[model samples]
Target: MAWGAAAILFCVWTLPFAELTGTSVTCTFSEDCVLPCTFKASSDEVIHWNRNNFIVHSYYHDADDLEKQDKHFEGRTSLFKDQIKHGNASLLLQNCNIQDSGQYSCHPSTTQGAQESWVDMKVHAPIRSVNIEKIDEEVICSSQGIFPAPNVSWTTDPPTQSDMLNNSTQTTQDPNGLYSVQSKVSFMGNVSDYAYICSVTSADGMQKWKTSMRQQGGNQLPSWIIVVIVVIGIGIGIGIGIWIGIWIWKKHQTEKNRDGVGNPGDQVPSGAFIAPGHDHVPPDEFGAEYELLTLWVTQKLTMPGTSQDPSAIREFRGPLEPSLRPDTIVSVTGLSQQTSLVQVGKSPC
Candidate 1:
């Protein structure tokens, strides 16, 4: 029986004794995070947390000991001192950053045994707002304050081939280790023909943001083109105004001339005849030649004993008759004795 008990004690001591527990922890950038660990409770307890064999935090003798802590974790790591007796060896990491993301191991020891807990930490700065703008022939999409880099993609309402889309993207990291991404897509044809969409995704694919832009009709026209159109419109308006003003002035002059011609005191040129009881005969109606012919015919008809026979009427020379070559003679005929009248140059004589 002693041999059996000795063998059992040897077996217990030889068996695998180190307990290992693993969990995942997600942390937001610039925020506090806790890596949980638990062990068997004991009066004399010891705790140590390490990442990649680098000391993150250590506790012993019922107090914190950070003299050997990594420089990167200085003033940024702590332990829950009151909870250590309760088998809680959780590490409080302050102001978490992207560099702090990795696997961490928590080791706790006591009179009972020692155990190791693993925590996989991930630090993320999620994507926020996506901004899209159209500048000339290019469309730009951008986002700021992201962690672990980001991805950018461009799409159109009427989807286009990847090769056909002329695009370029760039990402930059600021001093705070946050990423800013910008993408530009150049278009060859009319901007109003398609709608451009830009999507920004975090590196971990846990967050996404999208923005779309469509060119409006007013925005499609170039600034210089708009200016030219306005200038042309003004020129046309001024030309029309000038033409109307000239037409009105000419019409006024014409009306004034007509009124002057109709005045009773207006003098007529010498040798020009005016019909009885008429103040004036506008030259536009009956020319000077016609008036002179009418006057000569009237004087001849008023003479006493003038021949009344139509056959006797023949060509006769008069004071008002215009001089003519021998080949061209003025002839007066087709007279009516009762009315004592003749036709001369389309006017009744």
Candidate 2:
């Protein structure tokens, strides 16, 4: 009877520790996370947290004893000291990184009994931003700071055959175990005909990011090229304006010379006098006698001092009489209906 009672007591005391429970804990990269543990409240409590046989944290004698803590977790670990008395042995990890992911065991012992629990930890650096860029005949997609690995894919607005994509991808890991991905796709057709989309997804399928771009009418011009075109257009417009101004100035000079009002520096030929009002002379009244009058005036103009003195030229009366017969005027009027002639002695100098 004594042996039977001892066996039953041993089984009863060990039952709580034998029924171990497991839990999963997900932690964000570079953030604080807690590994949960619990046990029945008892006196003389002792708590220990470990991973892969490496010491993470320990507590005994009513205080933390970390003389054997792993170097990797030297200053990054802590326990809920005030809550330990209430059966809480949760481990608080600060600045969680990729290397902290794995299985961890929590052991809590007391005067009543001892128990062990398992916790699986996962550290994830989710996909943050995806970028798409076009360079000449190629399109590139890229992303950085992802955990595990990443999947990259390219698509078009007007979808094409998978074989026609002609793309290459590369993924690299940093010293911190975060992943970075880059992809490039060669384009053969017009850019305006289709839109390009880039998708980056985490390996665990928990995080994803997408970016897209397209050219409206044709391949987009670089900023330097657009600036050059605008500058050239402005230069052409200025050149045209200068050309038009020169043409107008030349036409004005020609009209001035024809009107006998040319510049002061212009030279006049000998025996060719400038007659200010000669353009207004009526040819019908003089008829054959007009040539004789012009020749007589040329002879006088050739004489020195006569060309300079307007009074001397006005004093001489031509061979034609100042007054003409009304019958002669009436006869000239009948032949030329549209002719408007200046009156005789109107000073056609």
Q: What's the lDDT for all of these models?
A: 0.72, 0.72
For candidate 1, lDDT tens digit of each residue in 8-60?
99999876478998999999999999989998888789899999999999998
* TM-score: model 2 vs. ground truth: 0.64
Candidate 1: the clashing residue pairs are none
lDDT of 2 at 232: 100
Off by over 4 Å in 1: 1-16, 191-193, 218-349
- Per-candidate alpha-carbon RMSD to the true structure: 15.5, 10.5
- Model 2 has an lDDT value of 0.72
TM for every model, in the order presented, reads 0.60, 0.64
lDDT score of residue 176 within candidate 1: 83
